[model samples]
Every structure is written in C-alpha cells, then in structure tokens.
Target chain A: MTLTKQKNQLPVFKKMSTQPWSLLAPLLIVLLGLFLYPIIEVIRYSFTNLRFGRIEYAYTLHSFKSVFTDRNFLDMVRITFTFVIFSVTFQLINGFIVAFAIYIGEKLKLKGSVFVRTSVIISMAIPGIIIGVIWRMMLDESPTGILNYYLSLFGFGPVRFLTDPKIALISVIIANIWRGTANNMILLYAGLKTIPESILEAADVDGAGSFRKVFSIIIPSISPVLMICGLLSIIGTFNTFDMIMSLTGGGPAGATEVLALSSYKEIFVNYSLGKGSAIAAIILLINIIMAMIYFNMNKKVEV
Target chain B: MKNKKTRGKKVLIYAIYILTAIFFLFPLFWTLCLSMKTVPELFQVPPKILPKTIHFNNYIHIIKNTLVLKYLKNTFVLVGATAFGTLLISIPAAYAFSRNKFRIKNNMMFGLLIFQMISPLVIAIPLYSYLAKLGLLNNYLILIMIYIALRVPFTTWYITGYMNTIPKELDQAAKVDGCSRIRIIMSIIMPVCVPGIISSIIINAMSAWSQFIIPFILVDKGEKLPLSVGIINLQSTSEAITTHYLAAACMISVIPMVLLYIIFQKFIVSTISGSVKG
Candidate 1:
C-alpha cells in the first residue's frame, strides 16, 4: 500500500520542482558555522602541539603518545571508569527502587505520597554545583560539620568523607545520586502511570502478591522506559564534571577524576590541547558506541 | 479481617512515604535552617538544627554586598535570548522535518540525535578558541549562541515528535483554502503546537538558567557571569564559611525557579513526561 502511494507521490514531487534549498540554506549555514566549524578546528588542533603562548602547527603524535604513556593518564582512565560504573549503577538501582516504592505507595492511597513526590521534584530543581557544595559542607570532616556532629551524638567517629582518598569517590557518588535520582524517579513514575490498572488487577486476581505483581506486570510494562533511562544515566554519569570539580576538585590525588574532569584539566589547567581533545574525542566515541548499542538492542526488542 | 489487614498495610505504606519524604527534603530543610542561623551558631559544637538568633540580614547582605542583581540580570537576559533563539529556529525546522516529505529527512533526524548524544565537554576546547577568535569571549551573546546550538537539537527532536502527532490533513485542508505554506504553518501548525512550545520554553529556560559549565568556561569577566557561576565565585572567594550568606545566595538563585515550578507545575510535569515518553 505504501509503495503504491509512493509511486503516485513521485509525480506530485516532480510537479513541485522548486527545491526548498533556499529555505534550508540558512539553517545549514548556521549549523556549519556554529557547530561544525568548532569541531573541525578542534580536530585540526588535536594533531598539533597547541599551547597558550605558542601555536606549534607541526603535525605530531607526541601528545597522543604522552596521553598513552603517562601514568596519570592510565590512572585517570581507571578512576573515570570506576567512578562512572559505580555512580551510574547505584543511581539506577536507587532511582528504580525509590520510584517503584513511590508508585506502590501511591497505589495504596498512602498519606504523604503527594508530599514525597513534591520533594523528589524539588530535589531535581536544585543545581548540581550547589548540591556538591552543600554535600561537601554536610560531609565535612570537621567536628562542627552537620554529618560529623550528628555522628558524635551516637558516639561515632568522624568518617573522612571528602578528604580521604578511599571515600572521596563514594562521597561524590552519593552527592550525584542525590542530585540525579529525581530525574530517574520522574521518568519511572511517568512510565508506571501509563500502565493500565486492569493488568495489575488481573495479576492480583491470579493470587499474585504485590511483589509478584510488580515483578511480572510493572517491570515488563516499563522495560522500554527503563532502557532509555538507563542509557541516559550512563551518558550523564560519564560526562559529569561540575559535581566532582566543585566537591573534591578530583583531589586527594585524583581519586575521583572522571573523564570529563580529566579532559577539562588537561585542556585548560595543563594546556595540553592535543591530549585533551584526544580524550574528548575518545569520550565522544564511547558515548556514540553506547548509544548505537542501545538503539540496536531497542530495535531487537521491538521486533 | 481482610479490611483490617489492608488498613494496616496502608498505615505501613504511609510510614514509608513519610520517611522517604523526609530523606528527600532533608537537604533543603537543612539549607533553610542554616540560612536562618549565624555563622558562629551554624558551626557550634553540636551543629544547631535551629538558629538561636535568626539572621534576617543574610538575605539583605547578599543583595547589598554582592553583585547578586547583576548576576540575576545577566542570567535572565542569557536565558531569555537563548530560549527565544532556539524556539525561532527549531519550530520551523521541526515542522519541516515532521510534515514535509523532504529528502534527507531521516538523515537530519539522525544527525540531531547524534548531536544530542555528544557531550558538550568534547567540543568545549575548540568552541572556546573559536569564540575567542570571534572576539566573543566573556560575552553574553556567545553564551546565548552556544546555548541555542546545544539545545536546538533536543528542542527540534521534541517539537518534531509533537508535530508528528498533529494530523497532516489539517495542513492539506489549509493549503486547499488558498493558504501559502508559511501561512499554513503560522496559522494552522503554530496554534496546534502551543503545548510543545510551552513545554520547550519552560524546559529550555530552566536549562539556560541552571547552565554552569558553558558559562563558567566561556565568561571570564565577573560582570558577565550567570547566577550559578556567580554563586560559585562568591563561595570560593569568601573568607568565612558564612552559611547564612551562602544560603541567602542559594535562595536568591532558586526562589524564582521554585516559584515558576509552583505556578506551572502541572504543565511542566506533563510536558516532561510527554517529551520523555516520545
């Protein structure tokens, strides 16, 4: 049916022979000038030794070699991967659990569900940088800090939250989880709301408990939303910079240096434009690969 | 017996809900309480959950002492310019992508998706240099342009999704009634896409307001800084950990957004859900 329509539409396309290039030209130019030009410039500069005081345009792989061989580079890569994995995994699980719990609570006509949902939304509204600062203050190792003060009430010692290398990554992770879980909750809550009540009722009639109903009905119903949310979480976690930069400054000996932070440090702080661009390009490539994998999986599932 | 068990379950659920609510709201509550406390009181041996003396001067001091007004003005201007610019370009482009059976339609859509996926940090280096060459560094216009470009793809994608749901027959009927293509778009399509426009406007405005990384890197001059960057600067340069001052700044930054959220909470939530679902 579509093929025949396409055959008929060919004549109409021919009759309307005035190409819309005039309309499209300006948009194309804007994109090329603003978006493409910078990208091309970055690629061009990445192969050369570009610095603050000097622009050595001579093509060399020296920067790439330095990035590959530098011990800090390897450590940065390891730390970045660890941070992304740990943060994203925890966020996904925590977000899913909270969202599901909220959904169940709402279904039971639980009091204060509205307030719980509102608070979640408010959390989403807080800026990431501010959240970092606030968490830093709360988790400050000083006796006067809120977390430490509260801990002392229970006879617990101050746990070095941001200062300790071992716990710094976890501290940042917790901060990110707090800032980001609201986004996931909104997504999952929306997904859950779209599920027909009849399906759950039918499952309940089959002698299914709430746990069984959630596992069998709700999970499968929202699988697509979950996949998209997961992919978003992965991408966002990989690119997170502000929280880490503000909180730990990727400090305590680069314990919490994610790729984005490391890339920024190389580019601006260290002025290694080539290596920084290389890292940036590598991050982009990884993101693209992940997105492609996600789309492919989504297609298979759809089929 | 069954009713009693269900009631018990309901009570348990309420308990859980209340606990989660407290957990979620604790930070904001802490900020509010700390805002009311003096620095010395805030840093007391046992950190004061409530202030002994409420410092109403904190809010006044933040406004009087810092460039809070300038930052707010800068942020508003940047956000307004970016939101308008993005909408102007994206709405027409999205219409073309959705309604017009143009060649390369799929390619354009795919290109937008790719752009959306790529992290901004990846392109920040060259963007900085490019803007510098153009003499646009530390300029609000440069930030505006970057915001527009960064947001256009997502805005276009979302508007395109919304546009697809609008029946094409409406366009056809308008054309038959002697309407030009532009007129058809202006009259028929624009009116129909109000929900999408509203959603995009709110979402983009919020994003532009909260933008940190781009503005932080691009704008070096203190006067050009947005509220987010300005707050960070104030924090770093200030001598004392003045909880009141910090909280005051935070309140200044967030109050407008909070009010906006309250006013348009329903539309905002619906639009967010719609965009995500699409």
Candidate 2:
C-alpha cells in the first residue's frame, strides 16, 4: 500500500523544486539569525578589544595573543583534557558494564532489571545544577560528611573532596561520569540488543565462557558504539560548566577551571569581551571539528 | 551441581542490581533524609543516619517564603515557550524533510547536527552580545527565542526521522483528497507520530529545565531567574542557610521532572531507541 504512494512521490523529486523551502524557511531563518550570525560575531569579536559596556573598540589580535600566551589558558587546556579523558574513559567502561548486566539479566529473565534500569535513568532527569548541589552535599569534606564518614569507618581520615586542589578535579570528573553514564548506557544497550542473538547463542553452544564471549564477540561487534560513546563523552564533558560551576565554581585556587568555565568567567566575571569571545571562538572551533567527525561517523548522517 | 551454579548466578545478578540501585539512588535518598532532619541534627558531632522525626517546616519555608514558586513560574514560562515554539517550527520542517524533494536536504541535516552537538554554554558568549545589543536582558522573550532556535535543529532532526517511518500513502491520500499541506501534516502525519512529537517535546523541556549559563547570563534579576539558576544563587550567597532547608528546596525542584519520567518512562525509552535506530 505504502510502496505505491512512494512510487507516486519519488518521481516528483527527480527535479529540484522550491516547494519545500516554504516549510524549511522558518528553521533556516532561525539558523541564520541565531546560530550562524552569532558564530560570525564570536569570530569577529575575537579579533578586537571589545569590552562590555564600552562602545569604543578596535580590531586587533591583542585578545588572541593574550589568550594564547596566558598561563591560565595553558593550565585550563591541561585540566580540561584531564577531565574529559577520565570522564569519558570511566563513563564508557561503567556504561558498558551496566548495559551488559541488563542484557544478561534479560536473557536470564531476572525480575529486577527494569528497576535497575530505572534507577540509572533517574539521574538523567535531574538538572545539572541540582546534580552539583547534591554532590556537594554528599562530598562534604568534614568528619561528618557522608562519604567521609563512611571512609572513616574504613580507617581513612576526613578527605577534602572539593577543597583540596588535587582531589577537586577528580571529584568533578566523578560527578560528570554519574551524569553521563545514563546516556552512554542507553546507547550501548541499544547496540547490544542489535547483535544478532543468534551469534551469542552460537557462542553459548560452542561452550564459550561469558568473559571470552564478551571479548571475542560482543566487544568487537559493538566497537562502533563504544567509539561513539567515547567521542560524545569527550565533547559533552568538554562543553559542560554548570555541574562544575555549582559544585565548586572552579574554586580551590582554580584547580577545576576548564575552558568552558574560563570563557564564562572571562565574559561575565572579568568583563573582557574580546578575550571571552576569543575563548568562545576556540570552543566553537573545537566543537565544529569534533561534530564534523561525529557527522561523518554517525550512521544517520546521509551527508 | 548445575542447579546450584544457576542459583549462585541469580544471586550475583540480584547483588549487582542492588548495588547499582544504591549507587544511583543514594544521593537523592540522602537529600531526602537531610531534608527531614532538624537544625541540631544537621550539625551534630557525627551526622545522624536518619532524622528522628520528619520535618515539614523546611518544605513549608521554601515553598511559602523563598523564591521556589517564582523560579517554578519562570522555568515554566521558558520551558513551555521552548517546547511550543520548537514544535511549531520543527513539525513543518520535519514534514518537508521527510516528504518533499530538496536538493540541500542532506547538507541542511548535517548543519543541524553540528549545531546540536555544540552545547548552549559554548554559544552563551555570542548570544550574550545579542542580548546586550537588543536590551532583552531579564526578558523571557529572548530566552524563549534562543531556546527555540537551539532546539529547532534537534527536534527537526528527530521528528523528521519519525516522519520517515510513517507510510507515504497516509499523507498522499490526504493530499489527493484535496487536504492542504497544513491539514495533511496536522491530521494524518501528526496523530501517527504522537509519541515522537511528545518525546521531542519532553526532550526539549528537559534541556530547557537544565539550562543555566544562558539564563544565568541573560536573566540577572532575582525574580526572573529559573529554578536552576535560582537554586545555585540560593546555595552560594546565603551562608546562614541550614542544611535541611536547602535539601528541601532541591527536592521540590526535582520532583516534577522525576514524576514526568516515572509516568512516561516507557514512552520515553521507546521513542529514544526508535529515534536512534531509525
């Protein structure tokens, strides 16, 4: 029934027509005005000395020079990469484990798989700022802190989870992993479900152990998903500031300040519009590069 | 021996499930526990594992005295406008993508993907300039516009995917019967993809709820702040805040989203899986 209608419709598209533009016009206008134009402005503003609230400005490379030469920017690059690498690495590993567990539970008809899935997904619904707040509460560094209290029971001192510069970034990364694992799990689990069950069943019949089956079969087949999850985690974690902002506000001598937060602080806190725009332009550049890779990699990208 | 081994495997699976639940759910549970405690209990020598009695006062104070309601109102305005505006623009664009012949279709879809990948915080700088220039500071209209624009790219892509799943005959028959383009989309395409549309709206609303950097930068007025921003300022500024009160406020802010997920959990899961696969 549907094939006939598709047949009737396909020929009309053999030649380009302006008919679709009418429907596409609104979205096109928005992209141009909001997405495209502002991006150009960010680029333009990056090359100038445009401070906020002072109309007088000139086009120069001072902002770019300062941003590149600044010691803080170098530190931020190192910190940002550390955060992204650790967050992405752990999110993938844990996300896969959770997805694998759910898959196994389903195969064996476990009763509580749905409940476990719900608990994991619950984190996704909570706002990022709230996640930071709750983490702060949980990570209170005093002796009475919930995490620290538990640690004391295990013969450890009260650890400064957020205050100590060395541990602060690690704490932020942990919170990020918690926030991100749900997305990775959803994606990985979907990929797992697609691995022709026949293959796994065949492995079972061949007397394959669970560990060997995962290594020899499941991991290889789902390598595409695993790569995508890692890429997305890096990009997403790199761009995030809310969780870090509310959690630590890039504090404890700025140990946790990543590039995204630096851009925000430059513009809003420090009032250096040119420098902020320069940082933002760099961010846009990185995002575009990563997104281009994603576009090419995504199976959905017909382009 | 085989039966005993299976029983042990079952125990292990249940153990994993229990541990996972505790890991994910404990913080929220901890907050709930904190919200019920008295001021004395909060700063006690060692924190009490549970409150002696549940306290409604913290919830009452935040609900009645604090900006929780105001923040809720502001968030509703922003989130609702985003969902509504995105749907209004994206549905037609999605219909166009799925049904019509277009030369730039692939390129446009790719452009949308790039925008989707770049988070709102990255664009906050550029949008900040526009907000300053237009003097839309503390205005819902500007927030709504930016949110809708950012969301249009994503929702359009997902909805287009949904429209692709639908049979062409459904809309073609409507067209042959002289149903206008608008009517065909509304009556035929939309009802068939209700779950898709609903899920798109839910996803848009979820992002809008989580938005902090944009609204935080633009809407600086105390009363104009959304829950996300308001709650942050509430935490940082007020040194005198008892722990229980803050927990109560946190609980209030998250409950709606939690409820929405519970009710539509299956719908959301299916829509997301379908969108990804399709």
Candidate 3:
C-alpha cells in the first residue's frame, strides 16, 4: 500500500514548487525590523550626545572618549571581570564535583539518588529575580538577616554582606554562583553521560586510579563541553542585570557595578543615551569576540 | 576490607551530596519558611526557624492589596503570546532551513546566532527611544514583539536541529503523496517534533516570564508590569517591604516556572546539552 502510494504521488512532488524563503521570510522580517535594526540604532546613537529633552544633537565621539577616560568606567570593568572570573570559577568547580558524584551514583545504582537530580533541577529553574530578592533578604545587615542568624549561632558577628563596599561584589558573586552552578552541573553531567563505559572499564582493568582516569580520560573527552559552558557562563554573567539591580543596585558606591548595570544606570537613571550606547557597544564588541572564538573552537571540535 | 572501603567512599559521597543540597537549597527553604512567619517573627532577635503559626494571611494580603495577581496575568499574557508567536514563526523557518537548500542559509543562521549573543540591555537605550518615538512605550504589543524577536534565534536554532533529526525520507514520501509543504510540516514534522517545540516554548516562556530589564524599562504602568518587575517594585516601595509579604509574592511568582520545570525537567536538560553538542 505504501509503495503504491509513493509511486502514484511521485509526479506531484516535481510539480509543487515551494520556495524556502517564503517560509523563512517572517522570521527574517522580524529579525531585521527588531533585532538588527535596533542594534544599528544603538551603534549610531552611541556617537551622538543625545541627552533627554534637549534635541539639539551633536554627533561626536565624546561619549566614547568620556567613557574611556572616566575612572568609574575602569572600576566597572574591573568589577565586571572580577565577578565573572570568581563566579565562573566557583560554578565550574562545584558543577564538576556534583556531576561527578551523580555519575558515580548512576554507576553504583544508588537508591534515593533521584532526589539529588531533582534538587539540582529545582535550583537551576529558580528565576534570577527571586534569587536576588531572597538573597537580599538573607544578606540583610541586621541581626534579623538569616545568614547573620546562622553566623551568630557560631558566635560570629553580624556581617554586612551587601552593604559594605568591600563585601558587596563578593555577595553578588556568591548569589550568582548559587543560581548558576546547578545549570553547569546539569550540562556537565550530560556531557559525562556521553563517555563510553568501555573506556572507563578498560582504565579500571589497567589499574588506573579513579582520579587518574578522570584527569586523563574523562576530562579530555568533555573539554569541548567545558569550553562551551565557560563561554556561556561568561556571557550569562556579563548579562547579569536584574540580580545586581535587586541585590546591590550596583551599590556601596558602585562596587558591584557591571557593564550591564552601568548601561542601565547611564541610560535610564541619568538619561545619558550617548554614554549608555557607548558602553553597550563595548559590551557587544566583547561578546562578539568571545562568540567568534567559541565558533572557531566549536568547529575544530566538530572536525 | 575492599568492599568496606568502597562502601565508606559511597557513604561519604552521599553525605557530600546531601550537604550540598542543603547549602544550595537553603535560600528557597528560608523563603518558604519566612513567608509563613508573622511580621514580628520576621523581626525577632534571631529569626524563628519555624513560625509558631503558619500565616496564610501573607498570601491573602498580597492578593488583596497588591498587583501580584494582575502581574501574574500580565506575565502570562506576555509569555504566552511570545511563546505562541515564536513557534508560529520559528517552526516554518526551522522546517525550511532544515529541509530546503538555499544560499545564505548558513549565514542567516549564523547572523541569528550573533544576534542571540547581543544582550537586550546593550540595545535597551535605542529600543526605548525608538519605542518612545513611535508612541509605543508601555505598549503590550511592542513588548511582546520584542520578546518574540529576542527569543526567535534560539527557538529557530533548537527547532532546526530537531528537524534535522527527522528523516528527509518522510518529507519526500509526504510530498509524493500529493501533500503540500505546509501539509507535510504540519501533519508530519510538527507532530513528530512536539518535544522540541515544547522545549522551545518552555525555555522561551521561562525567559520571557522572568525577563526583568526589558519589561522594567519598557512598561511603566504598575498593572502592566510582569511578575519579576512587579515583585521588585513591591520590594523597592517602603510601604510594601515587609519580609513575609515579599516572600509570599516571590513564591507566588515562581510557582508556575517551578511547576513547568517539574513537568519538563528532562526536556530542559536535553535542550541545554543539545546546544553544546550543536
């Protein structure tokens, strides 16, 4: 019946002419109108000193010059890089350990290990805004702070987790790591799952210790995944706005101020579209560079 | 002796897992615990580990006095429309990109990938001004359209990868059976790729639902604000800053996402891993 159906319908296949662009045009139009157009506008707007309410526009490179010359821009860059480095480091370490343990549990057929997986999922799905707000409550400087309550149980004094300039960036980093590690773990575990059991068994037969096997075998096999995760973590951390806004508001005198938050402040708060667009353009350049490297590495891995 | 040693290691690993779970989950657990406490309990010298009575009134109060419910409704409207629109556009695009051969296809996909990397905050200023010029600031249509654009690249990428896994033979077979391209896609590919479409929907829904800065700056009205912006607004206002009320609102905002995760946990995992593999 199927063979006859194909034979009878073969003529129709040649006669029907449907262009792929017809299907692709809607997405293309939206991307052009909304995505690419806005980006071009941002790049153009960055060159103009377009402050709100005074529309006598002077297109100049002053915004970029000021952003480059300002001491605060340097501080924001330092804070942003520092946050990304520390948070990604913590996430990688914690994610690896959890993923490894889960892999071991799967190998050993451990009962009740499903709960561990669920917990990780739960953590990953908790939205960043909630993470920021709840952490704010927990990190309150007063004794009422939950973290402070626990610290006092150990006879430690109440610490200004988000209030002090020195500790504010670290506090935000900790919150981000908490929110992000589980996602890293989930992805890493999936990568681990792809490794063939025969390789591990062969290593065991060769009397290779677990640590040696992990370093020599498992790590190399998953290095591509690691690279992808790291790049994504960097991008994701750089995009951190809601959390910073809710947690520290880039506060304690801009200690936790990242490029994203800086752009928000310059644009929305100060109504300096020129400066904001310049900073945003800087961010776009950084991301594009990172993505180019990612693509090159990814292609090599595929080959 | 060897068995005992391995058992000891296993026990140690489980202990570490449990300890980590506690450490990682503490914030959420604390939020839930705090939401059930009275205002006085919240301000107690050392916060009570368990509230003496589980105060149900916090939820009631937020529902009565705040825009929490309206915020949820607004979020659903925004996310639902974005998700539906994303699928509407992306499904056909993915089908074409996967099934048809065309010049500039790969370039288009790569362009979309680069667009994906550009965060909305980077373009927020220009977008805001443009929307203002068009008199569409605080407009639901503009915000939804933006959300759809923001999500389209990712949805297309994921769905195209999924469509590739579907055999071309099926398309050929359907075409020979006098079915048009649309018919083949809708009847055959769409049904087969439901999981992929769903994963895209859930991911888009979550991102759109939890989006902060776009809706924060774009929509000015309190009633129009999504849950994320609404909850933050609740916290920012001095009058609404009570711990229990904030906790309750936060919990309410997250429940739908949590339930979605519970239902589609595997799909989410597969999608993330799939991106890496791609």
DockQ of each: 0.46, 0.55, 0.52
Instruction: Report the poorest 10 consecutive residues by lDDT, candidate 3 chain A.
Output: A1-10
Task: Give every collision pair in model 2.
Answer: none
Model 2 CA lDDT for position A190: 81
The TM-score that candidate 3 achieves is 0.95
Docking class of 1: acceptable
Ranking by lDDT: 2, 3, 1
Show the lowest summed lDDT stretch of 10 residues, model 2 chain A.
A1-10
lDDT of 3 by residue, B1-278 (tens): 77986898699779868977887777888888888988788889867777788668889988999988999999999989999999999999988878665567777777777878778886567778878878888899989988999999889977887887776677887777788788888999999999888889888998898888888888888888989999889988948468889999989987788889888988888887774542
Candidate 2 local lDDT, B132-218, one digit each (tens): 788878877777888898899889988888787787767766666777888888888889989888898888888899888889887
Query: Local distance difference test, per candidate?
Result: 0.75, 0.84, 0.84
Ranking by DockQ: 2, 3, 1
Candidate 1 docks with a DockQ of 0.46
What is candidate 1's lDDT per residue for B144-180, written digit by digit as tens? Answer: 7788888887888788878877776677666557777
lDDT of 3 by residue, A1-303 (tens): 000001224444344436788899999999998888888888988999999777789999999999999999999999999999999988988888888888888778886567777777787667788889989988988878888878888988678898789889899999999878877887799889889889998998998986899899999999888887788888888888888888888998899999989988898889898999999999998878876776666566555
TM-score between candidate 2 and the true structure: 0.95
Q: TM-score for each prediction?
A: 0.93, 0.95, 0.95
